[model samples]
Target chain A: MELSLFDVVGPVMIGPSSSHTAGAARLARVARQIAGDFVRVSFGLHGSFAKTGWGHGTDRALVAGALGLTERDERLRDSFEMAKAAGLEYDFYTADLDVPHENAVKMTFFSADGGRLDVVGASLGGGRIVITRIGEYPAEVTADAPTLVIVQKDRKGMVSQVSQILAAHDINIGVMRLSRTARGEVACCVIETDGELPDGVLGEVRSVPGVLSARSVSV
Target chain B: MYSCFADVERLCAERGIEPVQLFVENEMRLTGRTEREVYDRMDARLTIMEDAANRALSGPLGSVGGLIDGLAQAQWRYAQGARTLCGAFLNRVMARALSCSEVNASMGRICAAPTAGSCGILPAVLLTMQEQYALPRRSVLDALLTASGFGAVVMKNATVAGAEGGCQAECGVAGAMAAAAAVQLRGGSLAQMLSAFSLVLVNCMGLVCDPVAGLVQVPCAQRNASQAVGALLAADMALSGQLFPIPADQVVEAMARVGRQLPIELKETAQGGIAATRRGREIAREILHRERA
Candidate 1:
């Protein structure tokens, strides 16, 4: 996407370092969207995020994001207390992850309803982030636009089916990535759209043949 | 593409339009947003910048690192005192710069003019200009759009990331952006605005981004204050018809070249410059220990 004047001038974020704080918060916020509602989340910091994330308030920012706070929320500073009040369990660990980026984190989230998810993302500075992985699938989700993540059985015409549904709804696809473990096995399709997916699009997608689960995320 | 100041100048000359007009139209074309929408968005950003610039003056803000707290309030008090060196306007400018940076360090909300680390400089100059001159909101917003134009050129030709180009990219470009905006706010000509932009880049070239403890405190906040002052001085020189030997686009390219030559240690790694000092190491260790505890 072309960089706008607004992109140059502002994200209007809670800050100290854009990469460590604002970007970290955004990465976690996107992770939350991908993972859905979670009662507990653990952040595994890597490289610079592990080295100086504490001082830069990456931990607090990450926690705030897990609680669904936007980067501009002033409650970011007191996010730990807010998390406590919200009954959101959180933990931070310095982990050795073989990520290319210095500002990376691996997050695992658990819900009281026995749902679990794993997301790994990196802060690419200036409050930008790329979610590199979701669950066991390698992914590239930037959250720059509204996105749909679909888990499905690797089968013929799955992409065409999803694209047709989106086309039927007048949602234009900007970028799409499809990955799978092996032929006819489980696969993940991540599609970023130019227009918002109207209500019931997810239901329509989930009802597609061989589709396992689907979620829509916007940031 | 608005790739350079020379292009901006040539276009303005060809069309006999102001830089803000060109910028606003370009934004409209690029984003498919109306002029009013663009202006309203910028006004919202201005509101954010204003809030961040003023928040720390009312009370001390504690930083997450425990490295910088109450410094902006202290500067505010000093600015308010009977005896100070920078006079009332510049002192408050410095204080507001510090205030925004302090708010940033404390994880308060702020607009990242280019990057969060240098968020203070532009808002400090623009807000102080508005306050001192009672400038119209339209004028301040125009100045902001003008600044973003210059910043976009820098981003196109070079960068604004400290990790990629050191503090020169973050704070230096921010100072240049602020200087250009200040020149516009003062009704200076396009040449003067470009001159101010070039002067700031020349003055702040090769500045490193070695935040102590790898945190955006200590030197970062002070650098914002000093660069805010530098931006004002650059604008003053430009408005007075002073010119640089090198053109603004070349200056931005030079900054990019110098930034590329900077070692990784000096580029936000916290492994060189002040971050490498013995005391800096001690502070890092202490902060880490405290956090672990």
Candidate 2:
């Protein structure tokens, strides 16, 4: 991604370190969006996030994010207290992800409606983050982009059909990745676009012949 | 992204405006926001910087690990004494910087002017100037934009990551940004601002990123605070007609090269420098044991 002036001068956030704190918050925020109405979140912090995260407020930063707070929210200092008031149940565990990236976290979100999602993300320095995994699927998507995330039955023409819809809408695809747990069983497709998805694009994707679910997260 | 500083300088010259307009335009293109949106957003960040620094100066807080705290108060005491080495203005710069750094160490909210570890430099310098000289808030924001312009240039040309380049990339670049902004805020021309920016980078080049115990406290906070003084001195020298000789772009490249020459142990690994010392290791272990509980 081209570096912006704000990327250099801003990302105004609560911080002792941008990666450990701000990016961690961002990871949790995305996880929050993925797992709607989550009641319980088990955070498996890895490497540097597990070792020194306590001192850097990574723990609280994650809690604030799950509560739908931005990094700049001044009430971030009261996240722990506010979380309790909001009736959110969460836990933290030290994780070993077999990865070298120092700032990593695995979040398991349990929604009140009996949905469970597991996400692994890394804070790639400077408050930028990548959602590296979703459930049993290996995926790569950045929060900096307007993205379409789809989980579907793995079969022929799934990639082509999805691109056709996006191309039809004049939405330029910046990046697209198709990763399946195994061939012809289940797959995840993450599309990052140059323009915002036109309204109702998610419904069109969901109505596709073989898609299990579709969601678009706007930047 | 811009490849070098000369490109930025040339763009600014052709536009017949300060480097700040370059930053504003670039921000608009990159973020797709209007000029009002960009400046207003920056104004909000500027407000946060001042608020965090002021909170720190109003009272000191113990760092989370308790390594450095109350030093701002001690500095204030020394500044109150007769025949101090630096005057009250410089003392306030240090105090403001220390306050923000110390606040950051305590996990208080602060702007990551470039990064959190070096957040204090620009704020300390600008907020101090805002109070001492009564510069308009808009002008302060413009200085911040001037700082941001060079900041983007350096981040693009080289590396700003301590793990990639060392303290020279983090605090070093921050000092340069602060110096350039200070020059702009004080009515210096673009040439003087660039010279000051180069001078600060030239001075801070090759500084290691060996924070004790992999924490952003200790040397990090102190560096953030002291570099404000370094920035002011650079700005003063540039304003007094001193030249930095090397162009800003080459200086950034030199800093990047020097960073690669630094050993990994010194690049935020906590395995060398003060972090390898007995006290440093002890502190790390103690903090780890406590956190586990």
Candidate 3:
């Protein structure tokens, strides 16, 4: 998509650093949307995020976002106390992860029901983020538009079925990517739509044969 | 997209329209939003800038890294007193710039005009102009639109991230944006506005980004204030009939080239310039010690 005038002019964020704080919060919020109601989160920061993240309030920003706070929320400064109150345990580590970007983080979230999700993302300056990996599937999810992240078995006609369901709802696909571990193995389909998916579309997607899980994320 | 100032100038001259109108119409076409929606969104950003510029004037504000605190209030106090040599207008401009930067460092809500590190320059100029000239709200908003157009052109031609292009890309572009807005607010011609924009860039070329301790405090806040003053002076120069030899688009290209040539240590890495000084390293170590404690 082309850059807008507003993108040059404003994001209306809480900040000491836009890439470190606002972008960090946004990345965490996207992670929260993907993995709902996690009980604990561990952040493995790399490069600049590891060296200066604390001074730039990256830790607070990440915790605030994982607690479901927006970037502009004033409570971002008090995120640690709020996380304690919310019973959302979090830990930060300076990991030596090999990432191309200077501002990257690998997050592992644990849910109360023994479910776990791994997400790796980078803050690509100016309050923009890209979720690079979800679990074992390498992905590129910007959350710029309403997106559907579907995890299913790598089988024939899976893409056709999902596209047919979305086409039935009048949702135009802006961009779509499919990734799998191997042939006929677990796979991930990331589809960004031009508009929000109508209610019950996700349910229809989940009910599809061989579809393990389907989640909608909009920012 | 409106990528170059030369094209913008040509289109404006041919159509006999202002930059603000062109930008608003382009926004309407791109976002598929009504004119009212675009203006309302910009107006909301103006409100946030106003809050940040004024929030730190009355009291001291603390930064996240503990490197600097209450400097905005100090500047405000000095401006209010009779001791400043630059008179009330410039003093208040610097104070407002420092105020907004201080608020950003303290994790207060702010509108990042181009980026967070340089958020203070544009708002300081616009708000101070409005207060001093008693300009109408509509005119100030129009000036803001003009600045956004100038910024969009810069973003298309060059970089705005400090890490990519040094402080020149962040603070220098911000000053240029403010200078263009100032010219528009003062009813200058399109040529004059572009001259002011180019002059600001020329004045701030090659300024490095070296925040002490990798926090957006210290030199960054002070640079905002200095660049706010620089923008006003550049606008005044354009209004007074001074001409810059280079065009605005060429200046932006030159800035891009210079930013690429700057060393990595000088580009927001906190490893060179003032950040690498003995005192700078000492301050970084102190902050690290405190964080560990």
Model 1: per-residue lDDT, tens digit, B40-100? 9999999999998999988887776767688778888888888998888898998899899
Runs of candidate 2 exceeding 4 Å displacement = A77-81, A111-115, A155-176, A193-209, A216-219, B73-83
Residue-wise lDDT of candidate 2 within A1-219, one digit each (tens)? 156767877778776888988888888887777665678899999998987788788998899888988876766667889989999988999899955578999999998788899989999988888888988888887868888889988888988899998889998999889888855498988988998888878888999999998877655
Model 3: reference contacts kept, as a fraction = 0.76
Q: TM-score of every model?
A: 0.97, 0.90, 0.97
Per-residue lDDT over B1-293 for candidate 2, one digit per residue giving the tens place of the 0 to 100 score: 35577777777788797778877877788788999998898888888888777666655675667776776766666666776788888887887778778777877788887888888889989988988898998999899887888888888788888888888798888989999999998888888998999998888888888888678887987898778899999999999999789998889889999989999998988888788989989998898777677
For A1-219, candidate 1 gives per-residue lDDT tens digits of 146898899889988878888888888888888887789999999998988788888999999888888888888889999999989999988898877998999999998999889899999888889999888889999999999999999978999999999999999999999988645399999999998889999999999989998989877
Cα lDDT tens digits, model 3, B1-293, are 35699889988999999999999999999899999999999999999999998888887678867555777778888888898999888888998898889899999899998999999999999999999999998999999989998898888879998988999899999999999999999999999999999999999899999999888997999999999999999999999998888988899999999999999999999999999999999999998988889
How many residue pairs clash in all the candidates, one count each? 0, 0, 0
In model 2, what lDDT does residue A20 have?
87
TM-score of chain B of 2: 0.95
> Which model scores highest in lDDT?
3
| Candidate 1 wrong stretches, greater than 4 Å | A113-115
Clashing pairs in 2: none
TM-score of chain A of each: 0.95, 0.91, 0.96
